[model samples]
Target: MEPIKILVVDNEEDQRRLIGIILTKFGYSVKTVSSAEAALKDMDSTNYQLIITDLIMPEMDGTELCERIKRKRPEAKVYALTGRVELYDDHKLEKFGFDGIIQKPISMNSLKETIESAVENIRRL
Candidate 1:
């Protein structure tokens, strides 16, 4: 079986590395990038099964990034990893092309479940 490939995009180096480490420990193939621009460039060459991006970032925000990604890869599973979940409702998130939102201050257990569920859904497709 192939490992799930994930791309995590965050301006904060600590946040990026933390997610990468956690996903790696979860037995996922993870890649981390510092900026949305960098993430877009990386996507040009690679297709990740899952993309977790910070809502707030320099230059391009997660919503915009997800929108652009979806335009390119409509099947891409792009999600928001933000703390301010209250600011954006499901309608807004969906309109921006995000498949779902993952709240920040992440819980390892939930993260694992989320990823597993997503992978399962992908497999079904």
Candidate 2:
């Protein structure tokens, strides 16, 4: 069986590296992109099982990225990662079509659980 492919999008090199390393260790095929624009370009060729993007980014934010992704691939599972969780309400996130939200200073357990749950959800669909 092929490993689940996940994209981690973040402007911070450290954050992207940390997420990539952790997901890779967990037996996922992980890719990292520095911006939503890059992520969009990557998506054009790859079908990612899950996409986890930082909520606050330059030019295009995570919500905008999610919107764009959904337009092209409505089945795509996307999660918003942000330190400023207080800034977004559930309605806003739901409107943006995010499958889930991952708070910054991520907990490995939570990240794993979220990813597993998302994969399971995808399989059910």
Candidate 3:
């Protein structure tokens, strides 16, 4: 089987690298982008199976990125990472079309399981 291709989008370099390292350790093909705009540009170039992005970004936030990805590539899975969970409700997210959410400062275990679960769910769809 092909290794699952994942895109990690975050404003913080450390955060992007951390997520990339963790996902790469799990045998995923990970690409790290500094912003949602970069993510969008790369989305068409690479066939990413999933995108894990920070909610807050300089431009083209995670929600907008998710929307664009969903519109362009309906099968691409999206996971939002943010420190402010209260900024958006579950129903609001559903409207934006994100597959799931990951709170900031994620642990390896949770990050692994979340990615695994999201990838698995995408496979089933």
Candidate 4:
């Protein structure tokens, strides 16, 4: 079976490393980027099955990144990852059309399940 390819975006190096470790353990191919701009540059060069990014970053927050990703690759699942519960509310994610979300300090199991469910839905679409 082919590994699921995921692009993980976070300004914090430690957080990005943790997510990468979890995803890699699940046998998925993961790429880590420090900024939304870096993620966009990589998107132009490579294809990804899903993109998991932080809601609050230095610039070009996750919502904008999600919008751009959806515009460029509508089929790819977009996830908003953050510790802030506020980002999950206000119906902003739905309005932005995010496929799913994973909270920050995410556990390996939770991350795996979220990714699996998101990928399944994308496959169905």
Candidate 5:
């Protein structure tokens, strides 16, 4: 089977590339974007089933991005990658259409498990 194609959106170059590297090591097709706008543009040409976006950004935040993406592709798995996980509630985030939240200073093992579960869930569907 083809590896899951994922799009990551983060304004921070270091964080974006780091995630790309990690996801690549996991043997997935990973694409990283520095802004939600760029992500949206990329989506116009790519069929990305999974996306990880920073919760905070310049013009458009992750919340808006998530809502827009969900509107366009409700089945897509879009997760929020943030350092301020404590600043928001899971229920609220879910209501806003986030599939999950991945906190900053991420744990590789946990991320791997989370992605594995998401991929498995996608495959099952």
Candidate 6:
């Protein structure tokens, strides 16, 4: 069976690398992009099962990215990652169309559980 693929989008190079490394260690095929625009471009060729994007980005935020992705591929599972966790309320996140939210300074256990849940949900459908 093929390993589940994931895309990590973050403006910070360190953050992207860290996420990629962590997910890869967890037996996932991971790709990292510096911006939402680049991620959209990458999506053109890659069929990523999950996307985890930083909530605050310069040109295009994670919310916008999630919107665009959902428009193009409604089945796509996208998660929001934010350092300022309190800034995004549940309503806002639901309106933004995120499958889940990850607070920065990420908890590996939570990340794994969220991804597993998303994958399992997809499998069920």
Clashing pairs in model 2, backbone N/Cα/C closer than 3 A: none
lDDT per residue, candidate 6, 1-125, as tens digits? Answer: 68888999999998899889989998989999999999999999998889999999999999999999999888888999998888997678989899888888978898888888988887676
TM-score of each: 0.96, 0.96, 0.95, 0.92, 0.97, 0.95
Comparing 3 with 4 on lDDT, the higher-scoring candidate is: 3
| Model 6 whole-model lDDT (C-alpha atoms) | 0.90
Q: Which pairs of residues clash in candidate 4, taking residues 3 or more apart in a chain or in different chains? A: none
| Residue 13 shift from truth in candidate 2, angstroms | 0.7
Decoy 6 TM-score against native? 0.95
Off by over 4 Å in 6: none
lDDT of 5 at 92: 84
User: What would you estimate as the lDDT of candidate 5?
Assistant: 0.92
Tens-place lDDT digits, model 4, residues 1-125: 57778999999999999999988887889999999999999999888988999999987999999999999998888888989966487477968868777887787788888888887775676
Per-residue lDDT of candidate 3, residues 13-90 (tens digit): 999999999889899999999988899899878999899988888868888989999999998888899889899777
Candidate 1 stretches greater than 4 Å from native: none
Give lDDT per model, in order.
0.89, 0.93, 0.89, 0.87, 0.92, 0.90
Which wins on TM-score, candidate 4 or candidate 6? 6
Task: Give the better candidate number (3 or 4) by TM-score.
Answer: 3
Model 3 poorest 10 in a row by lDDT: 87-96
Local error of candidate 4 at residue 117 (angstroms): 1.0
What is candidate 2's lDDT per residue for 1-125, written digit by digit as tens? 78989999999999999999999999999999999999999999999979999999999999999999999999999999999989987778989999889888988999889888998998787
Tens-digit per-residue lDDT, 70-115, candidate 1: 9888988988999898998879999898888888888888788888
Q: Candidate 1 has what TM-score?
A: 0.96
Selected candidate, larger TM-score, 2 vs 3: 2
- Alpha carbon lDDT at 28, candidate 2: 94
